[model samples]
Target chain A: MVNWIGLYTLTSREVGRFFSVYRQTVIPGLISSVLYILIFGFTLEQRISEIQGVSYTMFIMPGLIMMNTLTNASSNTSSSMLQMKLLQQLPDLLTAPLSGIEIALAYIIGGAVRGMVNGILVLLVGVLLIDLPVHDIGGTLLFLFLVSWAFSSMGLVMGQIAESWDQLAMIQNFFLTPLSFLGGVFYSIKMLPNWAQSLSYFNPIYYMINGIRYTILEKSDSSVMTSLWMAVLLTILFTSLAILLMKSGKRIKQ
Target chain B: MPELAIQIKDLKKSYQDVFALKGVNVDIPKGEFFGLLGPNGAGKTTTINILTGLVFKDSGNCLVFGKDTVSNYRFTRSKIGIAAQELSVDWFFSIENLLFFQAGYYGINRIDAKQKIDSLLKRLGLNKKKNSKLRQLSGGMKRRFQIAKALVHDPDILILDEPTAGVDVELRHELWNYLRELHNNGKTILLTTHYIEEAELLCDNVSIIDEGKILKKGSPKSLTEDLGKSGITVQLTQESIDKKLPMLDLDYSIEDSRIHFSVKNPELVIPKIIQELTSKNIAIHSIKTETSSLEDVFLSLTGKSINE
Candidate 1:
């Protein structure tokens, strides 16, 4: 039986946790988004012109949105879970009537909420400052939700695996950040050398960036369906891994 | 017969190189105030942890109300509320939020949960500090909050692991009174404590565990009668100090003008001792009898103090 009340309470607590620290969780993403818009969009637009028919400023919006979504979603769960573990407060959840799947879903929903909120806020910033025309509002929202959910699950998996803040930072710095930067966030794959483009095909985050760009700009280098499928696959992969780890009592349980 | 709230059979658990529980067995019936009496590393907390699904047992079975704890964890967990030994809390949240969340975890909705939480806060004397974060509260207040959290869910079984370990005397007595009231209201409480007096005062049945093994189990009175020895000390006059004592078969000692006797029954031996001393022309100055306590029972069973 599902514990609906427990699940709701846990999810709300997670959301409220990050929301309470909005200065640290929410504003940083917005401030950085504005900075990127000013530095890369306006300053470089004069020299760079356009990437794929849209203006240089317009082309980077989707990538910026996805970047914000990915970072916030993943960080929310990873930090929350890690802090709870380190503080030995996880017994509150473990000893509760909640099952492994219910716990995982609550955490994912919390992360996804943060992810979606930050992603949409960045998109709104784009719309407000650049007068950026959104191609499809519904599709953009759907894509944001899916990507946020996927990355949130991935964050939970990371949280389960990483033992300390140093370990978590290592995973983010060496793996997440590098791949995110290399995943065509700032430029199109067409601009990269052929070798780099081939490597980009191997990067799952590349598909996420590609999907969001297509959703917001109505232009893409790859098929949007493949991007959607990749998002679905990542979501299943990380969510299943997270639930399995929780059930097995890997790191969170002893 | 009322079903046993807790039943364990040859339950075993080991952590790496050390064994925390080695073939331990215990049964506690419904509405009974049971205590797992032990020293620091006696596996009392480990047993509670396993029962609450926080730790896994290496072998044997543990059941809550005839339901296997591991197999029926959801039902078992929902029926059991535990206050852990350590102060495990999220300092960021207020006491009210913590209790509210705990109630919700047991399937209680906000409306019903609020009433219960408010009553709990008032009962625990924490209503004034409901909005205070854990770090802001004193150690005694935090301890009270922990109990409040455990009771918030209103589980069928309340497991308190050293609930008053670090609290002051005033709070401890208040907690004892509150616990007695809870027991009177028919809440089956399983308490684990190293404080022998606490166990003797509160528990109807106690299992004295040491080094992960149960040394003895019974009511405090029965255990003292069976395993403990009473002591009788008689202070004699200076003139009788040099007199030869009677040939008593029991273990005894003489110190200056005092003669001490260690016997199973102080009541039965006191008259014989008085007659024997009187016949010998020994004058008695004063007499004192000490009843065997649970501490004495624990000492006689384990060859050491429970506090050690």
Candidate 2:
């Protein structure tokens, strides 16, 4: 039997850890996302006028929200696990009456919550500043939740793989952060050269942004079905990989 | 009635090219206070890790509560609690929350977890600092909180892997009292420590390991008696005492400016040597007796000092 109580407890602890440092994990993402929306969406839209039949401001808002969600989601799990590893506390959790799947799920759920909450907070910032319009509210929320789960799962995997702080930061800098910006958060794929646009399709974060954009603006640069399927696929793959690494005690064992 | 709380049958684990545990076998019975003595890199922590599911075993098997640790891991883990050498508590969480969450990991309900956390905090003398963040607490307090986290679940067995490392004597003594009380109540405990005195004082049975192999296994008293012999040292006023080796009457030698000899009974032989030295006009500075202890047994068996 799965220890439901133990799973809940581990999830609670993971959630509580980020909550314990809300000012660092939550507020910073919300502030930075809001600033991006203001400087790029509102200020630049005046000169750019419109993109793809919608105001540039509207087109960019979804991307900003997606970026923040993925970043926060990924950072939440990675930093938490990395801190536990460095502090030598992972053994405590390992010794608990918890299974590998339970541990992975707890971390994934924790990261998802942070990602979604930060995503919503950024959306709220856009709603107030750019007067953001929601084309489909339910789809927007669903895409946001799914994207959160996927990136958070990715973060758990990265956290397990990275041994030190510098290593984790390197992954974020070289991969997550750069790929996020290149994924069309600030520029539409159509605005890029054909070569860059094709490459953007390969960037996983591009699909995340495009999926969220389709939910909000009811328009997508790529096939909506493809974006949705990729999101689901990545979530399952990363989540399963995280659970496998944990079960094998890869780099997690004393 | 199952006699064993934990059973290891040729348990083995290796990392890359180094073997941490190589076919080590041990059986710890219920309610027994067992000590695992080893120098650094001798597989003590690795053994505990495998038992707790933190690390995978390469070969052989480990069982707790008569259940295989690998096949029935969660259930076996539920029966065990471990306080590791490192401070593993999250720095952001308060001591109270850390303990409460730890209890919950054992499937304890909220109300019972709270009660258990409160009681453990008090026993560890951490009630006043329950709401304090871990980073704010002193080293000793952190050590105590680690123990509190381990005991929060009230597992059938407790494994302490250097729980008192770098702790002060006062706090160590306090923890000893609490652990003794727990042991007296029929709780099985397996302790691994560098402190031979601590092992001698608390452990009923001990196994000393070196290079991932068990060198000696027995009670502290019996192991010392088997591996080491008592010696009498007769201090002399002059640097040379070689002439008195024959007069001392029992195969003695002067080495390092002192006359010394192994004796079955130091009480009987020490006095006779002192009297003989004084009557021979040899000024005796002081006479001392040395008895075998766990350290001596460990040194004799391992051929290396634990302190080194």
- Each candidate: RMSD: 2.3, 4.1
Regions more than 4 Å wrong, model 2: B231-288
Q: What clash pairs does model 2 have?
A: none
**CAPRI class of candidate 2:** medium
Q: What is candidate 1's lDDT per residue for A176-197, written digit by digit as tens?
A: 8888888888889989999989
lDDT of 1 by residue, B252-288 (tens): 8988888899877788889989998899888999999
- Predicted complexes: DockQ each: 0.78, 0.59
Error of 2 at A18 (Å): 1.6
Sequence-dependent TM-score of model 2: 0.90
DockQ of 1: 0.78
Model 2 C-alpha lDDT per residue in residues A1-254, reported as the tens digit of each score: 88888889888888888888899988998788767767876788789967888888788889989988998998989988888888887877788878888988999999999999999998888888868888888878887898899889889988988889999999999998899899888778988989999999889889988988888888788888898898888888888888888777777875
Model 2, B178-212: lDDT tens per residue? 88999999999999988989899999999888778
